[model samples]
Target chain A: MKIFQQSSEFDYSWEEVSTSNWRKYGPWNEKTPHVIAVDTISRTIDPHTGILRTERLITCKQSAPKWVLSILGGQDTSLVYETSYVDPAHKKVTMCAMNITWSDVLSVRETCVYQPSSSAPDAKTNFVQRAEITALCGGWQKIKNSIEQFTVERFQQNAAKGKEGFEMVLEMSRKVFAEQREMLRLQQESKILQEARI
Target chain B: MSASLAPECNQVKEQYDNCFLKWYSEKFLRGTATSDECESLFKQYEQCLSKALKARGIDSMLREAREDNRENDAEHMRPKP
Candidate 1:
């Protein structure tokens, strides 16, 4: 099943957006509580290409509706072992492979691209996310269909949550930047004061 | 939804993460990418994360993936003659 295929734009540069997305973790919404945790098992950087390879253990809480859960027959939390290739030069992160066990069984390959928005006058990043979901139904067509349907619905929910979470991360990044700038300004001011006294 | 695999690393990881985010947005993306303010914190966090991954038996998998990545890198870098 092809779960999510969407493009969205953010008010940040492609590099900023890509970096934030690469390190994302935690709950997207407080009320519904779809939590995501990522543990980086290993990270390697290729000296020649500057590409980063990251192996991550991604645990995601499936807060699917009761009906969907009933159809899927899986644990509340899904564990995915994913290998991601992060190409900073191209502003792209590709989940080249992912193995999901202990839930609505599936294997996922996804890619996300961050680029300048052609339509927007202001500098903005256009994010394109695409995923291919294959159900591990062990040859049962009925089960496969159920799993596929559940995945499509889940992807929809996740896509909305992802946008919200991205915005929050961007806001946090802005705040951090402002705080750093303020600190540098104060340090400069103090240095000038000390120089005058000297 | 995701918490750090190593709860012990969370503190340093959060600190390093905040620093990295600020640096990435303000410095790296803005063309001043040669800063090392968060280097120490990142190293500390990585140490903790490494221990956690070992505890969870994920280190082996990571090693295998890294090897594969290295092979792929080598293949890509090979001279085309």
Candidate 2:
């Protein structure tokens, strides 16, 4: 079995990083509008065990670059199924597997980890992604190499998207926080004004 | 801000999401962990999501994945002698 792994680190709080990943849809860049939709099949939290489980079905139109499409043949919109287990207390999410049917002959499994980075300052998170591709037929070594190269390039692209997406979410969160704080302050002011009038 | 897998559920999901984000930063991270306000919105969104998943033939896959994940978790938690 050939294993391809990549790791990326980002300057965002573990919560922001983890939450963005759990949300999933934020990571796609504008170029991949081919990502049509995502559907959460189920989400459950074990009251006793505190493990959070979620499953999502992601649909994407296969708009690979010209060379890749030429090599792999034209693929219709595909469903990429993924399930995740999150340990909130430990601040870890194990994307057990993201399975996608590339073709009748190719199956792909991607596993990912999102956690706090020990080497980074307290505000950073480390993302580790691994993909395992299996070709079900014979005499496809050359094709497999092309797929590997393509997958690596996709990983790098995704890493950049992930970082940018995380920052975007972080900025939005901060704005929300400030807005709520302002509302609270205004409410307090109103309460004090009413008391003084009485 | 990610859209829900079911686009129809996006409205409710956003409502719950906003609530959760506020709660997460203003209360949860500050150590309160209270989630009383967003519960109903979350349930509504989940119901919409469940229906959408069933339509997409994804419900069974989720069940299977959850079962596998449970088994894996159990294995991980098992004490190594």
Chain B TM-score by candidate, in order shown = 0.76, 0.78
For residues A1-198, could you state the per-residue lDDT of candidate 2 as single tens digits? 456688887777777766555444543334345456665555555565455666667777665788766655676666677777766666777776544544344556777888889987478888888877665445668876776666656656765665565566666655765797787777677977556653
lDDT for each residue of candidate 1 in B39-63, tens digit (9 for 90 to 100): 7887887898888777866667556
lDDT of 2 at A2: 55
For model 2, name the residue pairs that clash: A38-B5, A39-B5
Off by over 4 Å in 1: A26-32, A64-76, A91-97, A120-122, A186-198, B15-47, B54-81
Candidate 2 regions with alpha-carbon error over 4 angstroms: A23-34, A65-75, A119-121, A137-139, A190-198, B4-6, B19-47, B50-81
CAPRI rating of model 1: acceptable
Q: All candidates' TM-scores?
A: 0.71, 0.71
Error of 2 at A184 (Å): 2.8
**Clashes per candidate (backbone, < 3 Å):** 7, 2
User: DockQ scores for all the models shown?
Assistant: 0.37, 0.31
Model 1, residue A127: distance off in Å is 1.0
